[model samples]
Target: MRTRGFTRCGVIFGLSVVIVRLIGGSTGLVCYTAVESLDLGCLLRWDCLHASPNITYTVQTKTQGDPWQDVPWCVWISSRSCDVSHVFSDFELYNMIRLGVHLSPSSTVWIKPHKFDYSDFTFSPPSVSVSLKNDSISVKVQFPCATNRRCSHDACCPISKLIDPWTTVTVYNERNRSDNQSRTVWTQEVVSTVEFSGLSPGQNYCAVANFSFPTFSIAASPKSAPGCVETGSRWGMLPMYCVGLALSLLFLVLFLAGFLRKPRRDRTTADNPPKPLATVQDADSSAPPIFVDPCDIHVELVDDHSSIDSFHGFHKAPTSGAETKRSSQPTHFDHSRGVTVQHEVQDMTFESYN
Candidate 1:
């Protein structure tokens, strides 16, 4: 009977354990997790199938053969993602990085480790830009690592090392909404720009690009945002060229005309000289003439002592032969009145006899 009672107790204890497990739910945390290298840093993402408000997540990382260290920025958080790049900053690119997760009020789960190589990182979609020429379209694909800090610090590092060297570019004619052409370009050789010629002018074209890596078994990245452009007509620039040419010809003609006319004007001016200053006449002829005062004057007196004696009262002096020839008259003088008046044409003189 005691043995039977012991078996009954054992059965009851097992039943009690099963009931407790059923009420408390799963003891393990089921999650889907992935790690990827992003332009900003290394990202750790998780999707918990049985997450609860009471359960928090913490991420810890360690290099090969090193003790696991908790990520300070990702400690006991409820977020589905965390950045563990800080932990890998001092590690080499070839090192193996181990990642772990701790769940609050639940059990701990650890994911597989990944190599810190560039190839292991996911390739972000290339940035694309399109421009239209006369009859061609130019597409420029910029890689994500072109602006990445890690890539910039390494001189020997090329974006092709991180992404696929083979790029697939698809061009679409927006009018028909169909793919017009496709080309696989080697990114290392062409750099970031590719030109597609033999396209119809005056048509709207769009392009999308993605990276393909068959060697690494990596699927092509998501297609880039479409870059669109409208090509110019073949004859669209002809009018501008013609106008510029015409303007140049006009300028040349005007310059030549001016240059040629300069010599002719010079010759004409030389032939028809200006009038001499002496021949110039004042505009107003009725204006008064200006008189000038003589700086010095001289007087000539004929030796007429006998005439002076005869002019005791008042007598006219006989004019000398030269004086008669010059004046055609004799000069008269009054002596008795103590006044002498002489009639002279060129130089007249008056004398007082008082």
Candidate 2:
């Protein structure tokens, strides 16, 4: 028999699905008043009937004869509502899509008091003037290829090597129009290093760069440019290497401190203790040797001479004065009935002979 378990991928996929369902609902919507402003482009809206297969939409211009004249560009239809992709995002604004719709420069622009009627519905401010200009402008912009090298303060990592060697620079210039869209001017390719010239000089340009990242969304995003202000090259593996080196040094130090220190081995035991040997001192180098008389007339051999107990294991030899005194001491014997005394100098062995 075999058992099955969920893998990491399966768990991640399940969680992602749950999160999408929770946050990806269309129940969030709010209604508000509609007012037109300077940001004017062709406006169109439709309430998607739940049963309809697609949304039928139309264009209502707030400007004309402008650099960007109004004409039907694209039509999007979704089950819920067609998200006017550049025109109106899925956000609720009093006037979600405002083109420079106030009034055209050539005409006396005023808000139409009456709500104009449409085919299927009624809309307001059906007509307005084209208040815009068309002219060529130029500006100087620093252009650098995103290379794999370090970036300097003034130089940008060349965008080419940063994302793709052949990656192009896309610049979006939205002209005077209703919606912030209709302003996509150019997505030109930059193939040079120093600086790019002949850019739309005076107008505001919104530019984004692309680079490579490990994340899927980040890699797929067009704004992958890491700032050139701080770092020149990516510190990919240097930090990890430094951390590993530090840990290794720390472990080595700990091991040495724990095991390599000197132990207290200089000790002794009772069986083999150190002994101070007796020192041989010179008697008196200046004194001459004096010989005493052999017989002082009263020489007597004492019996039961157990009093001289100095011959057992004495390390020092007895002096002459000590021997004389020991010889003069009286001796008492308990063997009174029969006691015999014998004297010998060389082989003197003492024994009680009865």
Best by TM-score: 1
Residue range 33-125, candidate 2, lDDT tens digits: 122211111122222223224323223222122232222453221322121223321111222221111112332211121111111111111
For candidate 2, the 10 contiguous residues with the lowest summed lDDT are 119-128
RMSD of 2: 26.9
**Tens-digit lDDT string for candidate 1 (1-354):** 323432332332221110112234556445565555543245656665555666676777666667767778787787877756545543233445433445435655555654554444445677898987657898988765532334545553445644446788888889976648888876764356888987777788899998755344353567899999988876887898999999999999999999999999999999999986542245334446544333323334554565455444333544333222234244444433434345545422333243
**Each prediction's TM-score versus the true structure:** 0.45, 0.16
Look at candidate 1 and tell me the lDDT of residue 139: 90
Candidate 2 lDDT at 45 equals 26
Clashes (backbone N, CA, C under 3 Å), per candidate, total: 0, 30
Q: What is the Cα-based TM-score of model 2?
A: 0.16
For model 2, state the Cα shift of residue 277 in Å: 19
Against the reference, the lDDT scores of all candidates come to: 0.59, 0.28
